[model samples]
Each structure stands twice: as structure tokens, then as C-alpha cells.
Target chain A: MAEIITVEHPEDPRLGDYTSLTDVELRRRREPAEGLFIAEGEKVVRRALAAGYRMRSMLLTPKWVEVMRDLIEAADAPVYQVDPALAEAVTGYHVHRGALASMQRKPLPDAAAVLAGAQRVAVMESVNDHTNIGAIFRSAAALGMDAVLLSPDCADPLYRRSVKVSMGAVFSVPYARLDPWPASLETLRQAGFQVLALTPSAQAEPIDRVAPHRMPRAALLLGAEGDGLSHRALAAADRLVRIPMAHDVDSLNVGAAAAVAFYAVAHGRPGE
Target chain B: MAEIITVEHPEDPRLGDYTSLTDVELRRRREPAEGLFIAEGEKVVRRALAAGYRMRSMLLTPKWVEVMRDLIEAADAPVYQVDPALAEAVTGYHVHRGALASMQRKPLPDAAAVLAGAQRVAVMESVNDHTNIGAIFRSAAALGMDAVLLSPDCADPLYRRSVKVSMGAVFSVPYARLDPWPASLETLRQAGFQVLALTPSAQAEPIDRVAPHRMPRAALLLGAEGDGLSHRALAAADRLVRIPMAHDVDSLNVGAAAAVAFYAVAHGRPGE
Candidate 1:
């Protein structure tokens, strides 16, 4: 069980992690080295607990402490009980969701380890938008994709906005970063996975026609919304598939397109 | 051809339709009883033009007007050219896109009208987030879903944020409101459509097993993120189907889920 502490001062030193969050540059500068990330609302806080993230502390109003008692008790951190107004003042926002948790960020698994036993996976390159990252995780989790592998340029999956947009699925879906770009893709191929690059190019095969049984393990590679996959990444793929789109439509948003592709590849697999 | 009009004053009465947009209440109040909606950025403006919405007027910076010569020449409304700084001052924010257009809103098409000749369609109920509404439109268009029909509570598909988020596909997709709640769903069945309600319930059939060819027309019924479809709407469908989700996952965001469902229903058919 976690210790319950009462805090009245808005400028308490313990609350520093939650302060000035709207200042993007300051938050980014402090976040990475500090190894801390914030999870807001009851759903995400519960997920943080379930994911085995080491909780540092929690801030909540008395009402939420009661409502979320099961979750607070499951945490190993101190739960700071504060007045709603004081909590709002400390956090620099209204804090209407009533509860928040701060946890130590976990290191991602190795890309090879993430693909070792996976049947279907999503590989992202240069997807910098946090909301898109979150939404893709939510889709990957809901559609039963085995794991998500990211290139170095991808946004932090644990970013506050990503966590909120993913509706807590970021905690459940396993993801890891792959360094050295297209060279690292060889790790997936070594594990007998077919890397299918998703593109809008006319020469690509339609996604549905690819037989499921031929490739027991598959990786669906996606890129950023506008520029799409880099030339190097496209060249490295085992095959390229296009989700046939209407004329004059540029492409689907990266995240939404990922969901469609994930479903097409992951669907109908046994045990799902 | 659009007549060019020079506007020097930020508070000019002619700019009333484009002013106070950041104020939600004021903007809502100014909305035409049937047709007042805003479209932002050059691409969405072009889509709006292609969709045949009667443009009330356009506000553009000199740089944008020069760049969009072809689009401006195709417009039927007056083009008001202003300096970038003045345009920002009038709109209450930095107008980075350098262009905006106001259009008279159109009446929600009758559900029957939108469903006519449609093989695959999405029916939304209480999916009120504007960005989600826009994303669904983008997915529906890209995946070849023919139309989107909204329940009365759904957000305005033509809202500026929706237009921008949908990548302007909201302007192209046909949509109408279904009043009288679940009762309106009967209209779809009468049109030789089998209404498939998307739910996460364990008892529902897996989406992949759904026979697409048996029904010449199908409507996918989706709901908001949290509450999902109301009990009444769920009860109205011909059959319930679920996307096979992984362990401990609750659901995808309604918009993302809509994309997967749309792709499955549209692409699952025997022939393209």
C-alpha cells in the first residue's frame, strides 16, 4: 500500500514534476533525463499501475482518492491529497479529471526481442506526431497486433498527449525503437518476418490479395503522413502494399491508415 | 471569376462572418440556420469549391491570392485580400495557412438520399468530437466507403476543424442526420441494406466472418468513444459484429475504430 500525504502549498518541492507543463520546451528538456512521465485521469493511472511502471507519486483530490481507492492502493508511491483548487494551482490547470500519477519511464525492449515471437507487428518510421503515435497504439492493441516497432525519429509514446490520446493502450502495447534505420530491419527478416512497406505508389500490390499463411510472421511498415517512408526504408522492404484509395485523395492520415492496414494484416489470424 | 476586393480595416463590417471565430459561442450563434460553416487552409478551400458549396466570401493574404490564382479564378464569391498581419488580427490568432473561406451550410441530406446507390456506408450516433468526425470522413473516403450518415447529436462534419482534420474529405462525403433515434435505422433496412452494428461485446460475430456479398448494401453503425452505441441503436441492427481485440483492451477511439470497420466492410467483398 502507498503512503497518503496531505499537501496544501502550491509551490511544494515535491510537486515540481507536475509544474509548468504547458511550457513545451522546458517540459521536453527536463522530461528525458529525469526519466519521468506523467499519466493523467483514472483510466491511465490504472494502466500505469498495471504496466509495472515504478510510480513516484500521485496527486488527487479527496473525492477521487475515494473513487479510485483500489487504484491508489495498488500503487507503491505516496498519494498526495490536495484541495481541488490547490491541486489546480500546483498543476497549472483545472485538474478536472481528479487524479494523476507520475511514474519512472521504462526503457524500451530491443527491436529483435519485440519481434521474436510476434506474428503481426507494426513498424513506424519518422512518425513525429504524438497523437498519431497514440492512436496507432490504440489501434494496434484493439486489433490484436503483436507489437509496435518505431524508428528513432518517432515521438515518445509515453508523452502526456500520446498517453491521453491512446486511452491508456500505450501501457499495454509493447513498442521499441530501432536505431540505424533500414539496416535494423534485417533483424525482423532474420526472424523470418516479411516486411511489407505501406505506400500509395501505383506499383504496389493491394493489401487484401496477400495470402495470410504464406508469411507466418509479418511486419507492416508505415511512415509519416506527408513525406511517407524514406527512400531507404522503401528499398529495404520485402514487398510493398497499397490500400487502394479514391482518385484525388492524397492518403489517409498515418494513424488511421495504420489501423486499416493493421486490421487487414492481423484479421482472421487464428487465436485472435 | 471572383471579384477582388481590398480590405484595410480589421473591424470592417464585411468581415463579420469571419470574426470572433475563436469564441465558440459567438461562432455558433453566427452559424447560418442551415448553411454557415468555415473552411480553412488552401486544400480544404479547394475541396469546398469542388463540392459546390456556395462560397459567401474568401479572406486571403496577398501571398496566398497570388499563389492560388487557379482556385481564385474558379470561385464564385468575392475575394477579400488582406495583409497577413491584419488577417491574423481579424481571426484572433496567427493565420499560418494564409487562407480561409466561409460557405453557406447545406441541409443534412435525407438518409435515403445519401444511402442511394451506396454499397457500403457508415452510420454514426453521438460521435460528437469534431476531429473524430473529420477523421471518419477521411477514412470513409480513402477506403471507398460511399457515404456517412450522422445521428442528430454528431458534430457538424463541415465544422472548420473537421474539414482540416479530414483533409477536406468531409466536403466530398455525403452525410445526413437521422432523427427519431433508432427508429430511423429502419429506413436503411427498407433500402435493401443490412445494418451491421459494431460493438466490442463477446457475443458478437467476428468482423472477418461477415459475408459481404450476401448483402448488396451495408451500413456500419458506430458510436462515441466511451458510451458506444445507445441500447436502442444496438437493438436496431440486423446483426452485431466486433473487431477481434487483444487481451485487456477495451476499445479503439471511435474514429479509429470506424476506419478499421469501414475497411473491413468495404474491402471484404468478393470482388473490388
Candidate 2:
């Protein structure tokens, strides 16, 4: 079902998708342009395939070949077997998980399409950290958030780090980019979703009291780690909601905050 | 009040406390044996001091010298100012945070001591990842969990990475190691606390339905990321509870689960 090619040279052009992966800036630009994302490790690579992503190719060490035998047998894409040393040289790090797959990224749906079938949503603004975005996606999917709408400046969810950190959750959660940001938020309101901005502002109502879970349709807006939602993003929301914090903590990290908020909004809902 | 020393040599004995920071195994063993922990970046350093940890010494780049002048003037500990390159040479990475402090570690309170005045508590078992422990501490502190009790195998909360990742919340929240672990958990039950084991098992009650927040005194037990609560640990708990996860996620990362659990246990409680 698949062709296994033995690759010895680090410079092989066929391995282009797997090169310089540790160079985040280079991969960040190259991935979206080339319409591919790399999924690392057996679990994530398998998940990517299960989610209907087309595999461009796979790079695996000898030991992993047998471990991933089923996937290799089912794949139509070429599998390259390489020595671990060469794999490390090409990727700029030790490929500890022993397997990597380059998956073709499908075009993201428009915001309207993503929101059409979803009742609970997470709206993120300028959440550019790859790890934070990945963690949020994992929580969003796990907590039953229906969809994710990202500001144009949000980091690529399919970035290698994001995908790995998310444990391939990026493949599971349907997400779309809101090109005009705060202005595009009006579209959520028109869809009968109440947009609540999540912030640490003292003046904001406590999220528990807002009882987002009671809302028939709710979208919670979140921002980046340190500098939270921009003025316009805050102004656009129907209400400002803050997670009640104690012990004088300035705020929870974005991932923890997103998880708590997602849980809060999804709590008390009937089982799906 | 503090002596200002300019250290030019990377091999200087005075900088021993800050050596080989990137080597996890080395630092993990050394920090605890030496009874000191490192606080990196200005905010964490200030928070550590504010929490009453005595500074053994401080490592600062030239720029940080001014920013930390008030601290330097108030401390009796020696402050070593080094150039960035030398700081990098000594610590095994770029000291991007520009400040590092080696603070004395106090003797941890016993489990019974930590449980004495606490109503909401987090008990972690074999959660050896420094980042996860730090994150859990941050969430615990922010969510108003009164104390943390750790299985003896859990990572040190005062390890440098834990301190940095916790944003010094580790210092704010008191924690103790339960020497005999699952057996020691009985002390919590003895203290009139309901010990709730957080698991993803289908048999476990959903955390929300359990209403941990309504419990007069509750202790949430968390395990490591992958192999959650050892069978023995789960068997010891008064009840088994789980976050109501959707989309067939295997589980939330330990940090997120801890945050959500902490919020649930502390929700609707009187403000501290």
C-alpha cells in the first residue's frame, strides 16, 4: 500500500518537508505557503490520518517502522526510512518520538460555516504563542466547545509545535480565521450568540455569575497570555466576564484560563 | 544593605548556585540538596522575596542592576553582576530574563500541618514534571486552593523551572510531601476532608454533579499526565470524580485538570 524508500543523505530534496523544523520562523512561513503541516510521534501522526488529513509523506526510523506498520500499510504516501542521526541533523533536534508525517492542510472554513453548527465557541485574539494555541485547542475540543474563531494574527494551529502540544487536537476542532477581528465579532451576535469577552479587569462581572452555561448560544472571547484583549476587542463584546481569581494572582496562564472558561461555559449543559 | 560584586570569571565559586541550569537532572538533585531554589526574572524574584524567602545571592545582567536597585539596597545577600555572555556561559543558556536569585528553601510543613487550616486542597501523586507542578501551583493559588499536598515522588515545587513557571506562586502557596503517599492520604480523611480522586474512568461521577464547591472541606487528588492515578491511589480515595470531557478526548493535561478541579472545589465559597 506504500513505498518504503531508504534515505541516507540529509540534503535529499525529497525530505524538504522535514528539514529545519526547529527553525520556527522558517517553518512558520513555509508550512502555510506549501499547504502542509508536520505531525510528530505515533499518536499524533495516526490522529492526523484518522481526521482525514492527506499524508504527503512520512519519515520514520527503523524501530518505528514496525510500530507504525498498520499506518504504513494503509498509506498511499511514500515512507522514508532514515537513521536517527540523519533525522536529527535534518530536523535540527532529536526526533524522540521516532516518527513524523507531513499532512496536507485543508483550507479552513469561513467563520460563518464554522459557527453554523456550533452552540459554544471560543474566540481568540492575537494568541500567537504556538504552545498556548495548541493547549487551548486541546481544551476547547475536550470541553465540547463547538468551534474556534481566530483573529488573523493568531498563530497557525497546524504549526508543528502547536499540533504536537495539542496532541493532534488541531485536527479535531473545526476553526476559522476572522480576517477583520473585532468587526467580524458582529457576525457572532447576528448568529444569535452572545459574545462575552474574558478579561482580568476588576470591573468585569465574575464569569460564574454570568452563567455562560445557561446561555443558549455563547461565544467567549480570549486574548494572549500577558497583554489580554485589545481595547476594541473588549468594546465589541456584549459583556465583560472575568474568572474570579484569589491570592492576588495577576491572572492564570492563557491555557489554564481557557480551560477553566471552557469548562464554565460547558458546565450544566445536557450531555451530547 | 547588600554587597555589589562584579564577577567576570565563569568558573567563579560564588556562581556555583547558578551553574548548569539547563541540565535538569543535575539541577533537580542539586537545588534540593543545597536547600535553595532559583527565582528567575524580576517579577518572580520580587515575589519570592515578598513571600519571605531569604535570598542567598542574586545574578543580574547590567541592565537588571538598575531595575532591581531597590531590592539590592534592601537585601543583605551578595549581588553578582555579570555580562550577558558570562551569564550565558555559567547557566548554559541565554539569561533572557536578565535576573536570577538563589533563595533559601524553608523546611516544608508536614502534610498534617498544611491540612490544619485548609478547606480546599490539591493532592498530587507522582506528578514529576516541573512545568506541570508549577502550573498546578499557579492555578491552585489563583483559584484559592488553600494548600497542596504531594506524594513523596512529586517534583520539588522550589526547583528553578517550577519557580519560574509558577510565576512564584509556588512561594505563595504552601505545600508538603506525604511521605507514605496513599497511606498518608488517610490523614486528610481524619481531618474531616473528603478525598476525591480525579480520574477519566467511565465509572467516575462527573465533577460538576459531585458539586465539590458545595462540600465543606474537599481535597482533590491529581496524578501525572499519562498514567493517571495509580490503581492503589484511586482505591484509597473516598470518592472518584472526573471532569466531564467531550469529543472523546483521552484527558486534559494535568495542569488544566487541576485548574478546573480547583475552580470547582472553590466555587461559590466565601471570599478568603
Candidate 3:
């Protein structure tokens, strides 16, 4: 069982990880140990615990501690019980969910390790939006994608907003950032994975045409919303595919497009 | 040609329609005439103008006046050219886009009118998130969905955030509120449309199986994120359809699901 600590002061040094959060930009720039990645709500906290992340501590209102005793008992970290008002004061917002867990982010797995036995994978480049990153993780988890590979410029999937938006699915989906993009993509190709770039260019084949049966191990590459894949990334892909859209319409949001692509690829293969 | 009006005072009554926008709740509750809908940036303003939404007035910096000369020249309403700071002061935010348009709220089209001559439509229930509402419109426009039918509890699609998030697709897509709850759903069935409620229920049929080719006029219904379609709305549907998900995942965001459902139903259909 984890230790139970009662917190009375809002400025407790142990609660340093939860400070300055309203200034999200500064908080994001803070060094990892002090900055801390927070998972809010019972469901997300539980997911963090189950995913083998090293939990620093849990802060919860007394009522929540009683209500979520089972979940609290399962955690190997300490639990801090605070008054709801103190909890709100420390967090700089009204956390109605009453439970939050801070976890040390694990070292990212290597791209090759993530893709070794994977059948379907998503490769994202310059997707800087945290909500979109979280949504893509949720979809990838639900649509049977074996793993996700991110470019260095992508948003942090373990960010607070990403964790909340993903409903904790970010903890379940295995992902790693490729150090040298476009060049790093060669690793997937060398492993016999077909790298398919999704673009709006007319030359790209429709997504349905390149069914899952044709490519057992596939990497679906996506780009940012306004500007698509870089020339280097496009050149690196083995083939280009697009979701056929209505004339005069531009494109779906990156997150929505990821879900559609995951479903298309996963639906084609039954029990991979 | 639009009459160019110069306003020197931030308190000018002419700017009443453009103030107090940071307070979203208050802005949402503002009377249509007192709180005109704001369309920002060049593209959205052009779409609003083309939609015949009765432009009340426009505020633009000198740069926008020159950059958007063609669109401004095409409008029949007054255009106020203000300095960037003055525009920001009147609008309560940094008007970085330099162009904003306010339009009178036209009466919503009749539900039947929106449905008439439509082969594909999305029926929404209790989808209160403005961003989700906007994203659904964007997807509907991109996937060739002919109309969007909303329940009484749905958020206003013309809200500033919705308009911005939809990338002005809300101006292009037709929508109307459906009163009388599930009873209003019968109108679609009466018109020989198949009403398919999107849910994660085990009994629901997979969405791909009910493709657009199989149904003449299909209405894909969606609900709020946490709580799916209300029992009444589900009961009203002719059938229940689900986007197949992988193990342990509950569902996707309503907006993402709408895109996938729209694509599954609208793909390869003639004239779509």
C-alpha cells in the first residue's frame, strides 16, 4: 500500500510540480523533473498507474480519496489528501474531477523497437497541436494500430491536455519520436514496412486502393494542417495515398484524418 | 460598393455588435441584433458574404481594406476602416487577422427545407461543444454531406468559435434545429430517409455495411461525447450503426466519428 500524506499548505514544496500551470507556455518549457506531466481524473490516473509509469504522487480531495479507494490502493506511489479548496488553489483551476497524478515520463522507445512486430503504424510529422496528438493516440489505440511514430516537432503526448483529451489512451499506445526525420524513415523501409504518405496531391492513390492485405507492415505518414509533409518526408515515403474528398472542399483536420486512415487500414486486416 | 465609415471612438454605438467577446457565455446569450455573429479572416468573411447572411457591417484595418479589396468591393454593407489598435480596442481582443464581419442573424431554414433534395445528412442530438459542432460542419462539407439537422440542445453553429473552427464551412453547410425531440426525427423517415443513430452499442451494425450505395437517403445521427445519443433519439432511428473499434476502447470523439461515418456513407456515391 502507498503512503497517505495530508497536505495543509498550498505552497508545499512537494506540490511544486503543480505550480505555474496557467502559464502553459512557460510550464511546457520547464525542465521535466520540475515541470512534471500530470494526468487528471480517476480514469487517466488509473491508466498512468497501469502503464508502468513511475508515479511521483497523487493529490486528491478527501471525498475523492474515499470514493476512489480501490484505485488509490492499486498505486505504488504516495497519496496526498488535500481539501478541495487547497487542491483548487494549488492547481490554479477548478479541478472538479478531484484527482490528479504526476508521473515521470519514461524514456522513449526506439523506432525500430516500436515497429519490430507491428503490422500497422502511424508516422506523424509536425503535428504540433496537443489535442490533435491526443485524439490521434485515442484513435490509434481503438483502431488496432500497433504503434505510433512521431517526428521531433510533434507535441508531447503526455502533456496534461493530451492526456485528458486522449482519455488516458496515450498511456496505452506505444510511441517514440524519430531523431532524424526523413532519414530515420529509412529504418521502417529497411524492416520491410511500406511507408505511405497521406497527402492532398492528386497524384496520390485513393486510400482504399492500397488495402491492408497488400502491405502487412505499413507506416501511414501524416503532416501538419496548413502545410503538409516536408519535401524530404514526401520523398522518403514509398507511396502516396489520399482520402478522396468532395470537389471544392479542402481537407479534414489532421486528427480526424488519422482516425479515418487507421480505420481504413485496420478494417482491411482481420486478426493481425 | 460598400460605404467606408471611419470611427474614432471605441465606445461608439456602431461597434456594439463587436464588443465583449471574451465572455463566451454572455456573448452566446446576446440577442441576435445586439450580438451579431462575427466572421473573422478573409476566407470566412468571403464565405459569409456569399451565403447571403445579410452583412450588417465590417471592420478592417487599412491593410485588410487593400488586401481584401475584391471581397469588400463586392459587399453592399458599410465597411469601417480602423487602425489596428482601434479595431482591437473595439473588438476586445488582438484583431491579428485585421478583418472581421458582422452579419444579421437570418431565421433558420425549416428542417424540411434543409432536408429537401438532400441525399446525405447528419442529425445531431445534444452535441453542445461548439468546436465539435464546427468540426462536424467542416467534415460535412468535405464529405459531401448535404445538410446538418440539430436537436434543440445543440450549440449555435454561428457562434464565433464554431465559425472559426469550421474554417467557415458552417456558412456553406445548411442546418436547422429539430424541435419536439425524437418526434422530429420521423420527418426524415417520412421523406424515405434511413435514420441511423451512431452508437457503440454491441447490437449496432458496422457503419461500412450500411454504406451510402445501400441506402438512397441516409441520415447519420451523432450525440454528445460523454453520453451518446439519448435513448429517445436512439429509439427514433431506423437503425443503429457503429464505427468498428478495437479492444477496450469505448468510442471516438463525435466530430472524428462524424468524419469517418460521412466518408463511409458518401464514398463512391454518384454526384456526391
Candidate 4:
């Protein structure tokens, strides 16, 4: 059971984790360094708890306290109950959902470890937008990708906005960072996975023609929205594939492209 | 040639078209009532012009004036020069793009008119979110969808946010509103299209198994994010199809789902 403490001051040291919540730069650096990630709203908090993440603490408005009573009872962490105004003052935004939990972030598994058992994986390069990261994770999970590997420059999936946008899919899908980028991609090739780089370039073979779902093991590579795969990253892949476009439309947003590619490369695999 | 007007006041009558852009309800009603839509940024404004949307006026910061000199000299509409602060004061947000164009909204083509020459189409039901609508349009255009048919309650594709997010794809892809909803869906069937409803229900056949790509004339039906196709909407469809999901995930977001489904139903059609 958790102890309930009423907090009144915005500057309360006990509420440090929840302060400056709207300052993306500060929270981005602070949360990862402190090894904690915020799960906002009841759904994400519940998801974090269900995913076996340890709750460091929870901040809730009076109304949310009763709503989250079950989580509180099951949690071993302290619960801070604050007024709505105090909650907004501390967080720098109106706590519309009125419940938030700070959860401990476990060390990410190594890329090799995550790749060892996975047949279908998504490799993202320089996808630094938190919302795009979350959306890709949600699509990757839903469309049946076995795992995700991120380039070192990718944004943290556990960022508050990412967690909310993903509807907590960041917890459901296992992911790891690939350091040294294009060179580290050799790890997947060594693991008997065909690495296919997804690009909009006309020189690439059509993704459906490649028939990745038929492959025994595959890693589909994606890059940032605008710049796409770096030349080195593209050079590292075994092949380049593109979703067939029409009407001379420029390109799908990264999230949409990721979803389409994930479905093409991962969904409905043989014997699945 | 367009007349260049120097507007110092944010509340100038000529700037009325760009006012309160952040107020969704106000813009939603006013833009349509006035038969005008806002296209933001250089790319979108250019695309809008290329798509034959008549420009009512243009608002550009000083730096953008030289960059858009060709457009200024070409358009018959008045161009208002405003500072960043004045643009923000009028639009209720930072005009980071430094360009805004109010384009005359042509009367939407009737459903039958849009469906006339299309072999593959997307039918959206009550997808009222501007961002989702924009994202779907972008994917529809990219993935070879021939046209889009929206239910009456769907958000306007030409809304400022929708146009910006779509990169002006909304103008490239023709769309029409289907009045009297599920009843209007019958028109697609009359046009020899097999209307396939996309859902996550256990009853739905896995989309790949159904091989929507093989269908000669297909219309993919999509619904809003949370509550999928209404009972009547589902019943009106020829078949319910779903993208295979993994990890016991609930469903993909509407934008992702639309992209995957569009690719399945429209990309690389026979004889295209």
C-alpha cells in the first residue's frame, strides 16, 4: 500500500519529477538521466504498471485519487494528492486527465539481444520526433513487427508526449538502440536478417514486389521524415524498397510510411 | 498583377480572412460559410494555386515577399505584407511559415462525380479530426487511392491545419461529401466497387487473405479513431476486412490504418 501525502506548494521538492513538465528540453535530458519516465493519464499509468515498470511515484488531483484507487493500493510508491490548480502550477499544463505516474526506466537491452529472437524488426534512423517515434511504435506493435531497433539519434520513446501518443505502446514493444549506426547495422546481417532500407527513391524496388513477409528474417529500415535514410545507412542495407506511390504525391509522412512498410514486411507472415 | 498592400494593424479588414486561425470552431464555420480556405506555408500555397484554387488574398512576412516574388507577380489577388508579430496577432499563433493564403473553395464535386472515373476510392465515416483527415489524404494520394468520399460529418480537408499537415495533398486528391451516409454508400456498389469496411473485429477476414489488391474496383471504408464504423456503416459494406495485428494490440491509429488499407486496396492495380 502507498502513503498519501497532500502537496500544496508548486516548488515542493517531493514534486520535483513533475515540475517543468512542459519544458521539453529540460525534461528530455532530466528524465533519461534520472532514469524515470512519466506516464500521464489513467490509461498510460495503468499500462506502465501492467508492463512491469516500477512506479517511482504518482501525482493525482483529488478526483483522480479515487479513480486510481486500485493502482494506489497495488503500488509500493508514494501518492501525492494535489489540487487541480496546484497540479497545473507544478506541471506547467492543465492536468486534463488528472493522473500521472513517474515510472523507472529499465536499461535498454542490447541490439543483439533484442534481435536474437526476432524475425521481423524495424530499424529507425534519426527519427527524433517524439510523436513520430510513438506513432511508429504503435504501428509496429499493431502490424506485427517482432521488435524495433533505433539509431542512436532517435528520440526517447518514453518521453511523456511519446507515451501518450502511443497510448503506452512504448511499453508493449521491446526496442533497443543501435550505436555506431550504419556500421552497427551489420549486427542484424550477422544475425541472418536481410536488412531492407525503405526509401522514396525511384531506384528502389517496390516493397510489395520484394515480398518481405515471405522472408524468414527481415529488418526494415526507415529514416527521418524529410531527409530520409542517410547515404551510409542506405548503403548498409541489403536492398532498397519503396511503397508504390501514385498521382505524383511526394511521400507519406514518416508515421504513415512506417505503418505501410510494417504491414507489408511483417504482417501475415507464413506460419504465424 | 497582384496589388501589394502594407498592413500595419492586425485587425485590418483585409486580414479578417486569416484571423483566429487557432479557433477551430470559428474557422470551421466561417471558412466554409465564406467559401474560402487557408493554405499555409510556401509549398502548400503553391500547391493550392497549382490545383486551381483561386487565391482570395495572401499574407506574407517581409522576408517571404522576395522569396514569393513570382507568385506575387502572377496572382491577381491582393498580397498583404505583415510583420511576424502582426501575423501572430491575427492568427493566434506564431506564423513560423511566414506565409498564408486564403483560397476560394470551389463547390465540392458531388459523390457520383468524384466516383465516375475512379477504380479505387476511400470512404471515410465521421473522421472529424483535421490532422487525421490530412494524414489520410496524404496517404491516399501517395498510395494510389483514386479519390476520397467523406461522410457528411467529416472535417473539411481544406482547413488550414489539414492543408499544412497534408503538404497540400488535399488539393491534389479530389474528394466529395456523401450526404445521407450509409445510404449514399450504395452509390459505390452501383458503380461496381466492392466496398470493404476496415475494422479490428474478430469477425473480419485478415485483409491480406482477402487480397483487396486483386479486386478490380474496390472502395475501402474507414471510420474515426475511437469508435470505428457505425453499425449501419459496417452493415452497408460488402465485406469487413482487417489488417492482421500482433502482440494483442487493440488497433492502429486511423491515419496508420488508412495508409495500410489504401496500399492494400489501391497500390499497383492491374493495368495501371
- Chain A only: TM-score per candidate: 0.93, 0.97, 0.93, 0.97
Each model's lDDT: 0.84, 0.92, 0.85, 0.91
Q: Can you list the residue pairs that collide in candidate 4?
A: none
Q: Locate the minimum summed-lDDT window of 10 residues in model 1 chain B.
A: B263-272
Question: What ranges in model 1 sit over 4 Å off?
Answer: A70-76, A85-89, A269-272, B74-76, B269-272
Candidate 3, superposed: residue stretches over 4 Å from native: A8-11, A29-36, A74-76, A83-92, A269-272, B31-36, B83-89, B268-272
Off by over 4 Å in 2: A269-272, B269-272
lDDT of 2 at B272: 21
Per-residue lDDT of model 4, residues B1-272, tens digit only: 79999999987998999999999999999999999999999999999999998999999999999999999999999999999999999999999989999999999889889999898999999999999999999998888888999999999999988887888889988899998988999899889999999999989998877877778899999999999999999999999998888856768999999999998886542332
Interface RMSD of each: 2.4, 2.7, 3.2, 2.8
- What is candidate 2's DockQ? 0.58
lDDT of 2 by residue, B1-272 (tens): 89989999999999999999999999988988889989999999999999999999999999999999999999999999999999999999999999999999898889888889899999999999999999999999899999999999999888888888898889888889887969989999999999999999989999988888888899999999999999999999999999999947757899889988898888852332
Q: Say which prediction, candidate 2 or candidate 3, comes out ahead on DockQ.
A: 2
Separately for all candidates shown, the number of backbone clashes (residues 3 or more apart, or on different chains) is 3, 0, 0, 0
Across A132-226, the per-residue lDDT of candidate 2 in tens digits comes to 99999999988999999999999999998899889888989899999787899988998999999999999999988888898999999999999
Which candidate has the highest DockQ of all?
4
Classify candidate 3 by CAPRI docking class.
acceptable
lDDT digits (tens) for residues B45-90 of candidate 1: 8778788888899999998988778877887788999998888889
Q: Scored by Cα lDDT, where does model 3 land?
A: 0.85
* lDDT score at residue A149, model 4, on the 0-100 scale: 95
lDDT of 4 by residue, A1-272 (tens): 89999999999999999998999999999999999999999999999999999999999999998999998898899999999999999999999999999899999999999988899999999999999999999998888888999999999999999998888889988999998878999999999999999999989999877888889999999999999999999999999999888846789999999999998887653333
DockQ-based ranking:
4, 1, 2, 3
